[model samples]
Target chain A: MNEELKHYNDRAENLILNHLESGNVSKMIKDASIYSIQAGGKRFRPYLVFATLKSFGLDPAAGLSAAGAIEMIHTYSLIHDDLPAMDDDNYRRGQLTNHKVHGEAVAILAGDNLLTESFNVLAEDESLPADIRIQLVQVVSRAAGQSGMIGGQMLDIEAEGKNITMDELVMIHRHKTGKLIVAPIESAAIIAAADDETKALLLRFAEYLGILFQIRDDILDVEGDMSVTGKLSGSDARKEKVTYVSTYGLNGAKEQLELLKDDAEEILENLSSKLDTDELYSVLQMFAVREQ
Target chain B: MNEELKHYNDRAENLILNHLESGNVSKMIKDASIYSIQAGGKRFRPYLVFATLKSFGLDPAAGLSAAGAIEMIHTYSLIHDDLPAMDDDNYRRGQLTNHKVHGEAVAILAGDNLLTESFNVLAEDESLPADIRIQLVQVVSRAAGQSGMIGGQMLDIEAEGKNITMDELVMIHRHKTGKLIVAPIESAAIIAAADDETKALLLRFAEYLGILFQIRDDILDVEGDMSVTGKLSGSDARKEKVTYVSTYGLNGAKEQLELLKDDAEEILENLSSKLDTDELYSVLQMFAVREQ
Candidate 1:
C-alpha cells in the first residue's frame, strides 16, 4: 500500500479496536465479538470512510465510529459467510476462521452481535447530528442488507457450477462487494452533508473503484500464489465460480481493470477541489496493478 | 385472544403480508424471504406495536410499517435460531422452519434479508417523524442485537445442561426475549413523543409484561399439550434447557407470573390517561391465564 493509504489503514484499525473494546456488553460475547474483528485484515472499508471525510477537509475523528461500524458489518458478513453451512472455510487471512476457533454457535452469535452492535454504535454516535446518524443507518443498512451484499452472496451461491452471463457476473459483484465499498463513500457524503451532485460524483468514483477492486481480486486469484496472498490461488476456478477472470480471461480482465482505473481517475480529477484526489489516485494505482 | 386483540392481530398480519409481498427484489431469494415470514404465526409482536399505538389515541395505520418491521426482525430470529447449528428445530408453529423448507443457505439468506429489510422499512417510514424513525432503528437494533436478544441467546446456549440460578435464568430471558418485547412499546413512546417520565412508566410496564410473557411460555412448555399450544410440550426439558419453571418449579413459576401481572396492571393503571389501560389489562389477563 501507498504511504497515505497505509496511514489511513493504521488509523482506522486503531480507532476500530478502541471502539470495539469499549463496547458495553457482558464479557463473554464481547470477547468473541472483539475476537472476530481482531483477526486483522486490511481495513479497506474504514479507510474509505476516513479518506472521504478527509477529502472534505473535515476531521476524520467523527467518522471513525461510523467507519468502525461499517467494518463491524463487513466482519459480521465474513463470519457468517465462513460458517459450516456457507463457504465452510476453516481459514481466513492466514488464521483459523471465527467459527473454527469460537465454535459454530458462538461464531454465529458473535456475527449476530457484531451486526447488531454496528447499528448501536452508529445510532449512538453523538458527534454527528441525529439526522445524519439516521441517514447513515438507513444507507448502511441498505448496502449491507438484501439488496446489496447479502443478496449478492445468495446469487453467488446459486451461480456456482453454472454458466452465468456477463450481466449476471456484474450484478453479483456489484451487489456483493460494490455496494459495501460504496457505502463508506456515501456515508462520508452523508456525514459531510455533501450536495447531491457531489454525492453522485463520489458514488461514481466509488463504483469504478469497487469494480476495479473486484476485477483485480479475480485476476489475483488466478495469478497470485499462496505464500504472498495468504489464501489459495485459483480457488474461484476450483469451485467453478464465474468471475471477471473466468468470463473475460486474464488479458481481457486486465484490460477491463485498466479501464476502471482510468474511469475512477477521471471522476477524481473532476472533483479535485471537493476531495483529496491525490490520495484516491494512489489507492487506485495500488489496486490497479496489485500483485497480492 | 379477545376481540380487540384479535382484530389488531388480523390487521397486523394483513399489513405485514402486503408489505412483504410488495418488496422489490430479484425473484428467487425474494420468494425465499417472503416464504420465511409467510408462516402465519399469531403476529403477536406486531399486534403489540399497533395496540400500543391505539392506546395512545394514534391511528394504528401510522404504526403499520414499524409494526411490520418488528415482525420481520422476529421472524428472522426464528429462522436463524432454528438453523441446524443453532436449535436445529424442523418445525415452528406447526410448519417446517425456513431451512427445512428452503434449504440452509437460502434460509440463512432469508433471515439476513428480513433482518436488513426490517431496518430499511423503519428508515423509510413516511408516517413517522424522521427522528422517531431513526430512534426506532437504533432501539430495535439494540433490542434485537447482541446486547439484547442475541446476547441472551448466547447465554442460553452456554447455560445448556448446567445448573443455573434464578438470577441467571431471568437474565437470559430478559435479554433474549424481554428486550424485543419492550422494543415495540418503547417505539410507540418515541412515535407518540411521550415524556421521559411516561416513557419510564411504559418501559416498567413492558418489563413486567415481558417477564410475565416468558413465565407463561415456560409454564405452557411444561403443562400445555400439543393440541392447544401447537408445539411440543416438554421440549424444553428434552433439550435440558433452564427456564423459569426449571428454576422456580411449576408452583413458584405460576406465583411469579401473578406478581408480574399485578405489577404490569399497576403501571398500566397509572398511565390510563395517556393510554388505553383497559386493552393493556386484557392482554395481561390473557397472558396470565393463557393455556397456550
Candidate 2:
C-alpha cells in the first residue's frame, strides 16, 4: 500500500486500539475482550469500511461507529467459538482463549455482551444522518442473525467430524466466518449511502474476501509456526473439517486464494474511478498471503 | 386479568406460537425453544408491547415483528443462564433447562442465535416507519447490553461463590433479570410514539414492575414448590447464591415486592387515557406470585 493509505490504515487501527484500551470498560470482563480486540492483527477489514466510506466521499467519521461495532462483533465471535463448548481451542492469535483466562462463563457472557453491545456503539453515533442510521442497523442485524453469522455457525457445528463437500464447506465458512467479514464493507457502503450498484459490487468484493480469508487461515493451520499462530499446527486434523486446503490440498488452497483475489480485483471495476478504497484492494491481496 | 384481555392474549400467543412451530428450525432446537418460550407462563410483557402500540393508534401488525424479538431475547438469556457454564441451571419456568436436553453447545448457540436473531426479526419489519424502527432497536439494544442485561450478568458472575450485600444483589438482578423485564414496557411505549410525559410514566411503571418481578424469583428460589416452579425446592440454596429473600428473609422480600408493586400501581394514574394497560398490571402481579 502507498504511504498515504498506510497512514489511514494505521490511524484507524490506532483509533480502534485506543478505544479498546479505554478505562471505562470494567477489568472484571475487560481482559478477554482487550486481548482479542487489541490483538495485533491487521485492521484490514475495518480499514476496508473506512476506505469504502471515503471512496463515496463521506467523512471517515461517518463510518467509525460501524467500524468499531463490526470489530467488536468479530471479536465476540472469536471469544465464544474458542470456549470449551464450541471449537474448544486453547490458543488464538497467539494468546490464551478468553475462557482460559477469564473462566468459561464470563467468557461466554463477554461474547454475548460484545455482540449485543454493538448497537449501542452504532446508535450512540450522532454523526450519522437519521435515515442512514436505520439502514445501518437493519443491515447489521440481518448480517449478524440466522441468515448470516449465526446460521453459518450452526452449519459449521453440524459439518464437523464429517467428510463435507466443497460447497458445504463454503456455506459453513461464509456464515461461520464470512458474514462478519462482509459487515464492515456493507456497513460502510450503507453509511455512505452508496447506490445500488456500489452496494452490489462491494458485496461481491466481501464474498470473495471471506473465502480467500478462510482459505488462508486453513492453510496456516497446516504450516504456521506455533510461536506465531499460538495454536498448534495440524489442529484441524481431528475435526476432519472441510476447507480449501482440506478438500483441494495445500497447493490447491493457494491457487484458490489467487482466483478469489482475482475476483475481488475484478469487482473493483466499479471503483476504477475511486482512489481511497484502491489501497484496500491492495491490503486484501497481502492478507491473502500473510504469515501467521 | 379480564375476559377480553385474556382472550386477546391467548389469540396473540397462539398466533406467534403457531407460526414459530411451523418454522424449519431443527426439530430438537425448535422443541427446546418451545419448552421455555411457549411454556404456560404469561405472555404479559409482549401483550403490553402490542397493547401500548395500539393505544397510540398504530396497527397491531407493526407490533408483531418486535413481539417475537423481545420474547426471544428473554428466552435466550434464561437458557444461557441455566446452562452449566453459567448458573448451572436445571429448571426454568418449571421446565428442564435447554442444555439438559439439547446439549450445551447447541443450547449455547441456540441462545446466541435467538439473541442475534431477535435483532434480525426487528430489522426485517419493513412496514414500520423507518424512524420508529430505529428507535425501537435503540431502546431494546440499550436495555439488553451489558450495561443492561450483559452488564448485570457480569455483576452476577462476579458475585457468584461469594457473599454479596443486598444492594449489590438488587443491582445484579435489575440488569441480569430486570432489564429484560424492562424491555417490553419501554419498547411498547416507544412503539406507540407516546409523548415524553407518557414515556416517562411508562418507564417508571416498568422499572417498578421489573424489580418486583425479580424479588419474587428470589423468594421462590427460597421456598417455592417444585411442582409449580418445575424444579427442586430450595432452589437458591443449591447455588448458595445471594438473593433478596436470602438477604432479607421471605417476609422482608415480600414487603419489598409490595412496595415496588405499589409504586408501579401509583404510576398507573398518569397513563394516557387511551392506553388500557390494566391487564398488564395484573399480569405483573401474577408473575410476582405465580409460585403459589
The prediction achieving the highest TM-score against the true structure is: 1
Question: DockQ score for model 2, please?
Answer: 0.48
lDDT of 2 by residue, B51-80 (tens): 556556666555766677777787788788
i-RMS values of the candidates, in order? 1.9, 2.7
lDDT of 1 by residue, A1-292 (tens): 5565457666666765665566454566777888878898777888888778878888877687678888998998999899988889999888899888878878877887777778778887777777888788888888987778887888888887789898988888898999999999899899999988889999998988889989989999999977878878988888788788888899999999888877888888889977766657766787687677
- The stretch of ten residues in a row with the least summed lDDT in candidate 2 chain A is A17-26
TM-score of each: 0.94, 0.88
Return the TM-score for candidate 1, rounded to 2 decimals: 0.94
Error of 2 at A191 (Å): 1.7
**CA RMSD of all predictions:** 2.2, 3.4
Chain B of candidate 1 achieves a TM-score of: 0.94
